[model samples]
Target: MRAAVFDRFGPPEVLHVVHVPDPRPGPGEVRVRVLAAGVQPFDVAVRAGEMPWAKIQFPQTLGQEYAGLIDAVGEGVDDFVPGDPVLGSTMLNGAAELLCVAAENVVRKPAALDFPTAAALVAASQTASGSLLELGVGEGDVLLMHAAAGSVGTVATQLARRAGATVIGTASLRNHDRLRRQGAIPVTYGQDLIQDVRDLGLQPTAALDAAGGEAIAQSVELGIPLDRIGTIVDDKAAADHGTRVVRAGRDPKRLAAVIDLAARGEVVIPVQPFPLDEIVEAHRTVESRHSDGKVVLLIAS
Candidate 1:
């Protein structure tokens, strides 16, 4: 099987497509013929060695979320069968034609969604859901979300709105209109964020920090109880300040909830899928940090 392999990571240019041995599922695992692999900030971080835990056995295949068809199951796995479509999240080994993961990690894909979109929904959406859920966000809560146009931000806004929370989202001016369309009150990133929220007459009852700038950290520091704040990035800093980390690949129950939202059409993943040969370009596109939505890799059958 051919996989994109990198020895020492630096830039996207370091990635190369190489033919090596095909991986098989061990006990309690399943081998998936990957149809689409979702690339997130984490994927880019792994490629650049920014994420400390993304390192595993190298030469590494760096991807965390995928949607594919089951090809084979390990001895103890009975939850899935060959030909079934599944979507899942993992910490590593996802950027390839096939993946071997615990059967528990793979959830049956919604019949209504396509593979690439399914792949895009899990990691980002789940992280969003977990943070909101942990903060106990519900009806009548006014929520503040930093980086409101990001993949997780988009989903978080939608989900919070669906739950009847009034959402104020912070993004660049160019993204404010779309954020409003998604049911959020938009504030430009560099604007007086707190004063802007106050201008809307919405006192924020909770906040999710997806952007991780000093501004966000200072906002939490000024008043928002450290316990009420959660960040999907900057885990170390968040911890240092008593803010929570919305750790991805750490909660399976949250993942199931996210999958349910996608099935219900409460979450949307807008993206384009590139094949393995173009994997280098895919990584580059994500690294550029200008993608409005996800950029995924479609591992050819």
Candidate 2:
């Protein structure tokens, strides 16, 4: 199997695709023939050695979310058979021609969505869904989302609106129209972010910060309750403001629910794709933090 790996932690140039021995499924696991893989900011962190807790070895694979078909099932894995289409999260081996994941962690991919689209939703869906649930965002509540043009923010904004909440999304002026289409009142993010929201006559009852660097503090300045303000990034700022650090850990059930919504045309995630051979370019795009949508690797047919 061919996988993208970095021999040493450094820049995106460190990434390269190499062929390795195929991995077979173990008990309670399923081997997938990867069709697409999502490149996330977290993957960039892992590749750059910025995430201390992530165990890295020389020539380590770098990817977290993938969509593919089950090519083999280990003994005791009866739910998924050969040729079952699935998508799910993995630790660091998603950017490969084949990967083995725990059967329980895999979610059935809906036929309504394509492989790249399914892969795009894996991390964003879980993160956005979990963040909203933790912040208790619901009907009548005004939810403030930072980085409204980002992958996680895009999903969070749409989900909050679906729950009957009024959403105020922070983004650059260029994304304002896009946010409006997502059912959010878009406001520019900057020193006057609070005033911007106030000018719109919206009071934020809860906040979700997908963008770091002062997002948590700005939410606090809006007078939103500390507990109601949640952040998936910037743990230090979250601590400083005494706000909730919504871990929004990976959950297959949560991912599946969002996937179902996407299949029904209720949730949409734009995807920017690069071929697997151009792994370095894909990494650079995610590192730039300016991608208009989720960045994904087209691993196979």
Candidate 3:
């Protein structure tokens, strides 16, 4: 099996694909023939050695989310069978040709959603859903989202809208129309962010920060309470400003709910795709932090 790996992390160019021994599922696990994977900021940080907590070894595999078809199931696994279409979270092995994850963690993929899009939704969905829930966002609340054009931002905006909250998101001027179409009021980033939202006459009762920088401080200046301000990208900022650090843990059920809505076409995710062989480019794309929706890698069968 071939997989993306890095011996000594430094840059996207350091990533490359190499053939490794095929893996078999252990008890209570299922082995999947990966069809697509999502490259995330976390993967970029890991590759650059920015995340000291990540357990990296020489030639370590990269990736956290994938969509694939089940090829085998180990003992005690009864939820999935060969040919079952699924998508889920994995640990640093998602960019490979095959993955073995516990059957309990797998989220069944609807036939309506393609493999790459399903892969894109795995990590972002859980994070968005959990963050909204923790922040108590609901009807009658106006939410201010920093980096609203991002993957998690896109998903969060749609979900918050459905929950009856109005969304005001920060992004580049080019993404303003895209945000408006997603039911959000678009605001640009930087010094005017607070003034931009203020001009809308909508008071932000809650906020989600997926983009770092002064998002936390800006959210504070916008009059959103420290408790209602959540930062997924910067714990330091959250702590410094007395804001909530949204620790949305991985949850298959949370992922399934949003995915089901996506399958029914109630929510939308635009995809930026690259082939698996272009792993270096995919990593660079994620690192660029400019692509809307999710950056996906199409893993060929």
The residue-by-residue lDDT of candidate 1 on 4-113, one tens digit each, is 87887789888888987988899999999988888877777877888776545678888889899999999998889999999888766777888898988678887888
lDDT of each: 0.81, 0.93, 0.92
Candidate 2 on 1-301: residue-level lDDT in tens?
8999999988999999899999999999999999999999999999888999999888899889999999999999989998999999999999999999999999999999999999999999999999999999999999999998899999999999999999999998888999999999999989989888888877899999999988998898889999999988889998887999998899999999999999999999889999999999998898888777799999964
The TM-score of candidate 3 is 0.99
lDDT of 3: 0.92
Which parts of model 2 have CA positions greater than 4 angstroms off? none
**Candidate 1 lDDT:** 0.81
lDDT of 2: 0.93
TM-score of each: 0.92, 0.98, 0.99
lDDT of 3 by residue, 109-144 (tens): 999999988998998899999999999999999999
